[model samples]
Target: MASYQMLVKDVIKRADILLEVIDARFPDETRNNEVERDVARSKKPLIIVLNKCDLVSKEKLEETKSRLSKIAPTVFVSGKNRFGTTMLRHKILETAGIKGREILVGSLGYPNTGKSSVINGVAGKHKTGTSPISGYTKVLQLVNAGSRIMFIDTPGVIPFGENDEYIQGLLSVKDATSLKDPIGVAMKIIEKLCAENKTALESFYHITIGGQDSYDALILIGKQCNFLKKKGEVDDTRAAVRIINDWQKGLLVI
Candidate 1:
């Protein structure tokens, strides 16, 4: 992670404006506070970009934007669908307040937070490679974003000591098959869903989670999906992996 920190520092120093890309579903969880502090110390204009807005509701997006806008200029963008990319471009130029010269923009975010997709979205094409898998961007890339805007896309900066399995699972940094404790992560996901948007969870899995805890909910989903082992017991691991996969793929929102 030291190398990643160094890359972020280099980008902050070399670029004029910085974009902190975060998952719109879990803004606070995906944001790197330490990197934001570094950007603050540098006195560079930081834009808080809430990516994957398509997966979230408009009401929730407006609420999150209102809260995050107090810290910096915030923009809701769907990197996958290229939604609000024009607004993002305008925000970049408006924040930079520069003309007749190229503006170097630095992009930072956690793994799988759609940094590359945002770059490509703003560029109006596939300027950088992107994947759902984490750590896909291994090197710093400089792409011309047209209209005198240049972007410095760096690898996702996962803060040091951020090894929590649940957080990693939610961020898509570790996929369903990659997690060591898939069941535990899936339970956490269920708990969050139950608290935040139980209806969506029920609709997605076609299961009623009345008065059931996270584990029971997992078992219920397992039975609903017919993932059973011998003796008609629900396959906890398989069910957990399915939940994680769906959550990572944006099929299960909030």
Candidate 2:
């Protein structure tokens, strides 16, 4: 954790501008407030790049953009579908407000937030390697983004002692098999889906959530999938893992 903090601070000091890449579905949760404060202290222009916009709805994106714009110049980007990359490029130059000399842009975000994908999208090529697993970028690499803009791609930043299983599970920072409390995390995911998009959750699981809380919904899903134990009881752990896997894979949208 200390190493990550040092890496992020070093990148922030070296770069001309900074891009805080966050998950578009859970912008608030994925954002690193401490890093933002460091960027603030350094007085560097920070652009909030909301990646994975394709996984979220337009209305939600607009709402998130409006709220986050108050803090920094926010841009919605879908690195998967190559959407909003042009807007992101324009926004980066517009935020920097400099020309002639190359602009060193530093990218920061939590694990699995699509920092590499965003970089690739903006560069219009696969300049940096990307993976679905978290903490894939181990070292900082500089890539030419053209237009007098260069990118300093840094590793994902997570604060020290940030061991919340639910946040990690939701952000794909930890895979379903990696989590110790998969059932608890899946219940939280169900509650979030129930609150935000119950219809999508129901449709994806093929179960009616009428009056059923997160636990009941989980059991029902297990029953439907025939994930059962010796006594025909629902195998909750397997069901929970399935739910988390589906959520991380973008199959269950909220």
Candidate 3:
């Protein structure tokens, strides 16, 4: 983690402008406040990119853009759908101007926030290695964003905060595939959805949670999704993992 922090610091120091990629679903959770501070201190223009906009509603996207614009130049994009990345590219090109040289543009974000996807989306042909697992791109790589722009892809930056395992799992910093208590962590995701918007969760999963708690709702979803174990038993762990996967992959609507 220390080495990753140092690398991020180096990237910030070297780049002319920084594009901080944040998750549209949970912008605050995915943002690296420390890196933003460093960017501010360095006096470089920072662009806050709300990635995975396809996972969110149009109204929600507007709300987030409006709210985040006050902090920095904000753009909402989805690498998965290849939407709004052109705007990101134009922003980078415009910011760097028509200089006859390479402009360093670095992307930094937490795991599963589509940083690599966004980079690859904008690069068009020069794609980077993107994966569902966290910390997949371990080293920094420079890919050309056309002829004038040099886009730098760095390792996912997970700042030190929120020690709660539940929050970590919720943000996808925790490895759900190897979690010791998948059901427990999965409950956190179900409970969060229920608390935030029970209707969306129930509607997406096609389950009813009327008068029932998160666990009950989860049980219904497990059966509905056919996550069954031996002897007709509900595979709570598998269901939990699927829920996490759904949320991470932006299948679950807010």
Question: What are the models' TM-scores?
Answer: 0.90, 0.91, 0.80
Q: Candidate 1 residues 1-254, lDDT tens each?
A: 57777777878888899999998988988888889999999999999999999988788889999999999999999989999999999999999998889898989988788998999889975244322322233556777878888888776666525457788898888899988899999999999889778999999999888998999999999999999998999999999999999998889986
Candidate 3 TM-score to native: 0.80
RMSD values for the candidates in order, in angstroms, are 3.9, 3.8, 4.7
lDDT per residue for candidate 3 within 1-254, as digits (tens), equals 57667777778876888899987877767777788898899888889999888877787788889998898989999988889988998888776564878787878877667787898888886443332322333556777767566777776665545455655676677778866677787787787677666788988988878877766777788999998988898887778888877876657776
**Root-mean-square deviation of candidate 3:** 4.7
Per-residue alpha-carbon lDDT of candidate 2 for residues 9-55, written as tens digits (9 for 90 to 100): 77888889999999988888888889999999999899999999998
Give the higher-TM-score candidate: 1 or 3.
1
Off by over 4 Å in 2: 125-138, 159-162
- Model 3 misplacement above 4 A: 96-100, 125-139, 159-175, 195-197, 223-235
Can you give the lDDT of residue 92 in candidate 2?
A: 85
Compared with the true structure, model 2 gives a TM-score of: 0.91
